[model samples]
Target: MVHVVLTGFMATGKTEVGRRLARILACPFMDIDSLVEVAAGRTVAEIFANEGEPCSIPRTAAAWPRPGPSCASRPDRKRFSGGWGTPRAGRSWRTRTAHQIGLRASRRCSPSAHLRMPLPPMRSTLPSSASTTSSSACAGSWRDGDGVQVVEAEARVTAEGAVQEVEVGLGPRSYSIVIGAGLLPGVGTRLASLGLHGRAAVVTSERIGALYREPIVESLRAAGFHPTAVEFPDGEEHKNLAWLAVLYDRLLEAGLERRSLVVAVGGGVVTDLAGFAAATLLRGLPMALVPTTLVGQVDAAIGGKTGMNHVLGKNLIGAFHQPRVVIADVDVLRTLPRREFIAGLSETIKYGIIRDAALFRHLEERLSEVLELRRDLLVGLVAACCRHKATVVGDDEREEGGGRMVLNFGHTMGHALEALTDYRRFLHGEAVAIGMVAAARVSRALGRCGSETVGRLERLLKRAGLPTEIPGGMTPTALALAMQTDKKSVDGRIRFVCVEEIGRTSFVELTAQEIVNHL
Candidate 1:
């Protein structure tokens, strides 16, 4: 077994390159900075200021031995599932399985030299610094006197219109979220590569079915699987026990078996309903998602959270049934209604605020490009969101730890607004947009964050064409009541995910009335 470690200078895209390599290698991906943050219970910047950088070394080092999950049964070697999977664990750092890859940016490299850098072969050293002007040439590697090999590589963006993948590293249940243009037509071939065959159920709405059912079914058929398309009415209102029942009947009549694959192809509503169906039908089936909408691709379809909305709350009833794979075809997004597309940006913005300040800044800097549907930037945003979710989910798959709750940075009030409006006043993303504003305000009220932080968030939301204020006419009292029923509420107190800053969050518990006071 071999361990691959990505090390590089700041702004060199170590995290991004590591994510891509992990997806290609099919293994668990982790960052030293993230590990240190998790261990210290603080952000890297905070750690550096208070404890100094050297203090982080021990914390990061202690976490290096184990890659992921428990490996008690396999003492000799820790086997991973993805591209980075084959490394043996040891008692000491020197004897441990690790292949260091150092990333660097060259001043001479040009845009025309941009190309996807392939992974180096195991135990093989590449030229330390090949032709710097040639994008395809090796960036290089070197060995220390201690005999440890560290490969030096230059990270470059792939040419426009290339497929990228983000892996959700959950040990054996690990799966990849494929992002790119015109990917819908290749869904079958990808699924077949995963060793999934036999009966397959394609769950989607009639409207979505009319648009994509053919290509999906044809792809599955070409992959040698028996394909069946199950259609339902579209819209948030139809995501209920009734629709779930209807889905069950259609899948049953279609002769789906326990081992059959359930593929959902639509927006958040369809993903939630179909995922719930897949989770419960026949005691759960392997599922895949072809999320077409911006919201679906970034938030709904990636994580294993699948459920329909209850009359009282959004996602009130759901299970953590992960998908086997997710294919987010950017091309399908072209057909999305303008409002729907804009609404989807809410979740993407949430990701930036909660975990990735850089992503948030990128969105702020390139909002127009995103709005214009710049394929390259859009794909990067989607992939970045997926990476953040995958990291959080990997750490706390069941949300048993409060760690995963940060992902709900804006959902506390968002759900209430959705429930109060009866899912009519706003799209899911739009409501979340307002909820984020509310969360920011609450954070300031509680003194967890400053008005400046709130202002930056509000400004970004407004610039993105999202609602920053809750719609008038809905009493705060009524809104508070709706929030009381939220699943995150504890003993009638709403658990608000408050942003301490742009990319840092903490949970605060407040009663319904207390929440209204802040609002």
Candidate 2:
């Protein structure tokens, strides 16, 4: 068992490089900073700012894991490795270059000179107590207005084509969403890189399992893991407590341990049900999501939101247990029926209206190419949406903060519509398309945004082959009744997310009557 430790200056790509190395070695990876943040419930930046450097020194040292075949990472500026133990069964693969180079810097060297060249020695004794605050070293140059410009060496190309990683900034709970083509084959390696090994439960629906189970199982086996594939009946109806019970039974029968991982591979239904199981099984197990559908990739699979629907309302029973990682492979989306694929565009369009004008325009100008699934453009589109979601999640992991509510742009009525028809009448995204248009009308009625905003949103939905109006025969009274039970309702008022204009949104608390009145 080899314990790999990655220590470097701030922003030197220690975390990213550690992930790559862990993937290659088929071992688990641990970031000390991440663990510390988790333990403290605050970011490293906040810790350093509030308590100063010495305060985090002891905390950092305490976060180090016991020696094992694991990959550990932390910035070298604090030199916490002095307290780290070596792996019991094998040698410690610790990167000593950062500290060793710091030692060789002349006492009188200027900060700029220090930045211009590497220290004379690449390997030397680690310093007992080093200070980046010293005026004589270039370490200070790395800091500009509270930001660190990391060296570009952290970026590396692999044979798997281009991959875009968007990190969700949730302090200690932060995780990465990796977007690219053919990512399924690499899922095992990535999980192993996170220091996860041993038994894993791969959960999916019957249909998706048939299409993707073999590749996922094969990849896990190659990474020296024992994987148990579990499948349940597919559909929104199955995303309920009964199926969740079935998943728990299968997982336990498979003899999964507390350290065992739960990997969700399928569309939203699978991810939601499987994710709920992972969250409750054994009190909680590590989870990784590989969302197969367009809706799952751009929306469902990103945030830590997990749940099964209740008879009363959509996602009424759920937990916010974030996954260790999300692997979205665009190639698998090709298997989706064309209608489902087009419906997925609704969420992409929502991102534009609520947060990004440029993204909205891209959808307008490249609708045809995107529908064709042009590889490069699609990858970029998925990555861009992931970034927007990451930002919102990072700012409000639990949705307790007002900032994250913007993400609920169209879900208010969308959820109600799903429950009204018993999750059979319309797909999630299709319902959201109509909900978005309805919200826009509500916004206009309230004098928050102009008619032009509503028109543009409707046009985009039409171009993408999505419905922009409530279905006929679906009475407003029934819709209002269903919405009153929605999870977003507070004190009998819906905490609705309304569009102020393109790229901005505001929350409006309204009675179910107001919602139906606008529609």
- Model 1 earns a TM-score of 0.71
TM-score of each: 0.71, 0.70
**322-385, model 2: which lDDT tens digit per residue?**
9999999988888998999999999999999999998999899989989988665677788889
What C-alpha lDDT does candidate 2 achieve relative to the native structure? Answer: 0.76
Tens-place lDDT digits, model 1, residues 445-486: 989999998998999989989998888898978987898888
- Among the numbered candidates, top TM-score falls to 1
Q: Report, for every candidate in turn, its global Cα lDDT versus the true structure.
A: 0.76, 0.76
The number of the candidate with the highest lDDT is 2
Q: Candidate 1: misplaced stretches above 4 Å?
A: 1-161
